[model samples]
Every structure is written in structure tokens, then in C-alpha cells.
Target: MYKAYVFVKRGFVSMLSYRMAFVLTLLGTFVGAAQFYFMAKFLGEGHEFPLLAPYGGNLMGYLIIGTTFMSFVGVSLNSFQGAIRGEQQMGTLEFLLMSDTPLHQILIYSALWNFLYACLSTSVIFLVVVFVLGMDINVNLGAALFILLLSVVCMSGFGLMSAGIIMVTKQGDPITWAFGTLSGLLSGAMFPVELLPPFLRTVAVALPPTHALIALRKTIMVRAGLGEVRSQVLALLALTALTLPIGLVVFRWGFNRARTDGSLAEY
Candidate 1:
């Protein structure tokens, strides 16, 4: 835990060095939300989209949840891989591996700052949607937080798998690219999963982010309790159970292979 804190602190200080970028990112968050807000209102008003029925036909609120959750999902999906790439580019990968820290700890902690930033970004989006856009939000804080944490764990598994691929090949990871692209298109990030065809819907159901977004939207927009989202929660738990171990094993193998090949210092 202390080690994680140190990583988070280091990340925070590093982020502070680029104050303009941080401010621009925050501004961009609002701009993105506003664009979606107007679009949802324009398309949803006086129109019946069965895909949005679960959200009470409030497209803005539905989109707000989707966008916010995807922000975190984006971080969890890319942070570890990006961290590994950054370390390699900076010539620190070998030194970190040579240290006394367990490789898994290093891998996980390295992305802690990204996750923290993601949480902040998600919060900002939610605030903008609720306050700036005057969207009504019913937040079940406890359940929403639980779903968020589970989603992070589930997505981190994918991130670690991607990181493993990076460790070995050093670049051009089709897995990460495909997963990010498909997840964004199919995970109900900016829209509902039901809008997809049956086959694609099935694929979306298998992705942890789909279930996580559904549960999160329910908890936030509908003020649902944990019991109400039990199925989504269970699905996410099952995904985490299956993927986390596999990701760890793959990452360890890749790391060891890179070390053995003396390519850890190579970008």
C-alpha cells in the first residue's frame, strides 16, 4: 500500500509539471460532455429508441454515465501498457526489474497514477453533466463505487495482458488495439449495447465493461442498490476471477522472457 502511495505521489508531482496540459484536459472533458449532451437531446427528444428504454429515455443521463465510466475503462485498459512503454522509452525498465520490488507490484503500481487521474476525470465529467448541463442524477454512492472498483479490476486484467505483449514485442500490440477499438464500439460506452446486432450483442455481453457500465448506470441514474445490480456484479466478479490470474501469468512470462533475452533495455 505504501509503495502504491509512493507511485501515486510521484505521478501526481509529474502531472503537476504539465499544468497547461492538465487544464486543457479538464476543459476538454467539459467540451466533450457538452457535445454529447446536445446530441442526445437532439436525437432523443420526441423519439423512441428502445435501446434507451432502460434509462427512462433520458439520453443525456444515459450518455453521461456511459462517458464517465468509459473514461475509467480507458485508463484501466491502457495504463499498464502505457506505463510499460514509457519505462522502456525512458530506459528505466531494466533498473526497475533489477530492484528488490516484485515485478508484479512494479507493474501494478506503475499504473496507479493513471487510475487516480481517471477517477478524477470521471468525477469531473459527472459533475459537469449534473451541474453544468442541469441533468438530474440519482447517485447510489456505495453501489456506484463498488461497481467502479470491480470494473477497474476487470479492465486491469486486460491492461496487464496488453502490457505483457508490450514487454515481449516492444511495439505493435494487436490485442490492445483490437480490445480498445471493439470495447469502445460495443461496450455501451457512448450508446446502448442493444443497438448492436444479436451476434455483436453477445460479444458485448462477454466483455466486462459492458456489464460494468450497465450496473454503474443503474446505480447512478436509477439509484439502484447492490442487490438490484447483483447479476452485473456477479458477471464482473466472474470475469475478474478468470482474467486476473491469466493476465498475471502472461505478464510474468513476458517479463521473464524479455529479461532472458536482454531486451528489457530495448525500445
Candidate 2:
């Protein structure tokens, strides 16, 4: 816990050190939300798309929730890989590996600050949409949080896998790319999955984010209880069960291979 706090403190200080960048990032959050707002307005207020029936048919709110929730998902998916990449680039990876801390723990701790910042950014988006844009949300905070927790765990499995691959490849990873691109298009990030062709819809179901966005929207928009999203929750749990072990095994292999090849500091 103290180690996690140190990482968070370092991240906070690092972010504060770049005051202009930090401010711009916050500003960018609002800009992104506004862009969605206008796009939603362009579609006409209260315009009901047949596919968005489960989400109460509010496009703006749907987009806002999708983007906001996915920001956290992005953090979960990218932060570990980013941490590994950053350490390698900074020539600190070898030194960190030599320390008493385990590499996996280091990677996990390194992302704490990023997850915190993501929370702040998502908060800004939610505030703007709900308070300023007058979007309605009947959020069951507990259920929403539970779904998010599961989603993060599911995504982190992939993050660990990506981080491991980066340890060996020292280049862009395919796992992150696949999820970032495919999930954006197929996971109902900006639109409904129901709008997709039948085969595409089947493909979307295989992605964790597809289930996450669906459950999150239902929970936030319709105040669905945990039981109401049982299938999505179960799906996330199964994915987590399947992916996390593989991620750990892959990470172990990559970590050992990197150590044996003495490539930790090469990148």
C-alpha cells in the first residue's frame, strides 16, 4: 500500500510538473465531451434510435457514458504497457528489475497514478454531461462501480499480456492495438452493437468491452441492479478467469526471456 502511494505521489508530482499539459488535458476532456454533445444534438434531441432501446434512446448520454467509461478502460488496458515502455525508454527498467520489488508489482504500482488521473478526467466528462448538458442518469452507483471493477480486471489481463509482449518486442503491441481499434468499432463505443451485422455482432460479443458497455449503460441509464446484468457480469468473470492466467503466464515467459537475453535495458 505504501508502495502504491509512492507511485501515486510520483505521478501526481510528475503531472503537476507539467502544469500547462495538465491544464490542456483537462480542457481537452471538456472539448471531447462537447464534441459528442454537438454530435448528439445534430441527431436531434430525444431522437430514438431503435437499437438504443435498452439505454433509454438518448444518444448524448449514451455517448458520454461510453466515452467516459472507456477512458477508464483505456487506462486499464494501456497503463501497464505504458509503464513498461516508459521505464525501458528512460533506461530504468534494469535498475527496477534489480530492486527488491517484483516486476509485475512494479508494473501494477506504476499505473496507479494513471488510474487516478483517469478517474478525474472521467469525473469531468460526467459532470459536464449530467449537470451542464442536462443529460439524465439514474446511476446505481454500487452496481456501476462493480461492473467497472470487473471490466478493469478483465482489461488488465490484456494489459499484462501487452506489457509482456512489449518487454520482448520493444515496439507497438498487437494486443493493445486489436482491443483499442476493434473494441472502439465493435464494442458499441459510439453506437449500438445491434446496428452491426449478425456476424459482426457475434464478434462484438467476444470482446470484453462489448459486455462492459452494455452492462454499464444498463446500470447507469436504467438503474439496473446487479442481478439484471447477471449475464454480462458472468461473461466478464469468465473472461477474467480465462485471460488473467494466460496473461500471467505470458508475462512470466517474456520477463524471463528478457532477463536471459539481457534486453531489459536495450530499449
Model 2 compared with the native: what TM-score?
0.96
lDDT of 1 at 165: 86
lDDT of 2 at 163: 81
Point out where model 2 deviates above 4 Å. none
User: Could you tell me which 10 consecutive residues in candidate 2 have the lowest summed lDDT?
Assistant: 44-53
Q: Name the top TM-score candidate.
A: 2
Residue-pair clashes per candidate, as listed?
0, 0
lDDT of each: 0.84, 0.87
Model 2 residue 211 lDDT score = 96
* Alpha-carbon RMSD to native, per candidate: 1.5, 1.3
lDDT tens digits by residue: candidate 1, 24-78:
9999988988998999889877888777666565788888777777777778878
Alpha-carbon shift of residue 183 in model 2 (angstroms): 0.3
Name model 1 segments beyond 4 Å from true.
none
- Global Cα lDDT for candidate 2: 0.87
Q: Residue 61 of candidate 2: its Cα lDDT? A: 78
Per-model TM-score, in order, reads: 0.95, 0.96
